[model samples]
Target: MPKGQEGRGIIDACLQALGEVGAVGGWDSSSPDGVRLDGARLGVSVTGPVDPATGRLFTPPNTDSNLAGLDLGADLARSTGLDVRVDRDTNVAALGEHAFGAARGVANFVYMTVSTGVGGAVMLDGRLLRGVDGVAGEIGHISVDRVGPSCGCGRRGCLEAIASGPAIARRAGDLAEEGGPLHEILASGRALTGKDVDECAAAGDIAARLVLESAARAVASACVDMANAFNPELIVIGGGVAIAHPQWISRACECVAREALVPANRAGIVVPAQLGDDVSLVGAAFL
Candidate 1:
């Protein structure tokens, strides 16, 4: 159900289970690990470590890191007796969005998810950018602050480290434990979750506001950087935290428009994601 590298196995299991349920109608789903049907084969495109001129992924073995998903999908598909399709999650999300979500009529747009980690998808001229290796929108790994916190990817100050839901919650939890205003506010036995922090911030709590503001600023900075790099006409921000704070979204837009290169290109940009929790499922289904 959740999108992750492990989703390939889950999907395989689900497909096997579905075989016991008789004919499953056309279903819509999404997952970061890609998708498969009962009868189709899987394929993946990737940019290997090898030079394009050599047509080899690497020097010796000719392996490509980006095509790992494709290889895995194919193997799993054969074992599970079902067809598999592997592609980058962001590209799949973009296709799902363009086909049935907020960017339906748009020709160019970006879809971003700010959850446990940041992820993105881009659509240009109504077509998703699969990239040479199909791993196009790996925005979460983008280094935002060279001196900031380290990411799971062993990098420092990534957009994900600063703006993801888990990052915000962890920071809020740390702040709450500092025995300051946050502790005083949460003394009523209401746990100070990220959602609680957002609520308190919205209610004018200074300490909570500070935590949220810090997170928002980080997200805003990253958004600005992304806008400057891509100059997309629209960016749809999804994920639990973004959905919780409309003000944060607005502030991020303001920050990006003010600081991004070619600010004029930032105009008419809207922040909205049509699918809520179902985005991944829908995207996977499309895959």
Candidate 2:
């Protein structure tokens, strides 16, 4: 929760949840051979603006900064008395999908997350592609238009700047000022979200549908670029907005097929993740 308390609460919550259904035990980290791991090993998947080499986060965006620069992996291992492996949340999620979800048995694929922010993970030739500093999948930062909106990363035209959940909300707010259907979606003190847009669109709200379509097209453009450039066997889409609007997934796949190099041979497929929420959890397990 604070400096040196990285991931402690989550670990505790997980153990508590495990306790609800079965036996639980705490062993000493110092003496690994003293006892069994209760038949299951544990790992943690953490997100951030982080330094993967050190497991230290760069002042986490919009969240508590106290835990920044802490080694959550070492801390969890010390605190939980279990073998712990840590990596970017997206990386582990990719692992989860590859091992048990949508990308199961696929040798090469890319996983993209579109939510409050956009993030991605690359799995090629059966390995995760972590860049020099383990900061590889900055797909959201890929510039789509040189003059587009400014991203928090201090760059303009980043895919995330134009297509993330907050981006949709911001667009909705702007439209609300124009005295349209978006006004009914957001009232005083009520924050419009990508999910709100999705729900509203599903009910035949024209303005809401437009907002989603725009976001979907931006996402599709990015995915198409990845398909042509990265050339993975598949590109798996997940996260809040993509989940809320299933059609966006199909739209993205269709776009890639039409624009990219032989998708049937190179890009393989573009689809929704099968793991759902368990994507990250199963990924942590694999780690």
Best by the lDDT measure: 2
Tens digits of per-residue lDDT, candidate 2, 1-287, equal: 12234455655554444444334344422333233343355656776555655555566543466656666655555544556566777888899999999999998889998877788899889988887777788788898867877777778878887788898887767765444456765664678877777676777677777766777888889998998778888899888767877887888888898888768443337889888877888887777
Q: How much lDDT does candidate 1 score? A: 0.62
Q: What is the TM-score of each candidate against the true structure?
A: 0.72, 0.82
Highest-scoring model, TM-score: 2
Error of 1 at 136 (Å): 2.4
Count of backbone collisions in candidate 1: 11
Alpha-carbon RMSD to native, per candidate? 7.2, 4.2
lDDT of each: 0.62, 0.73
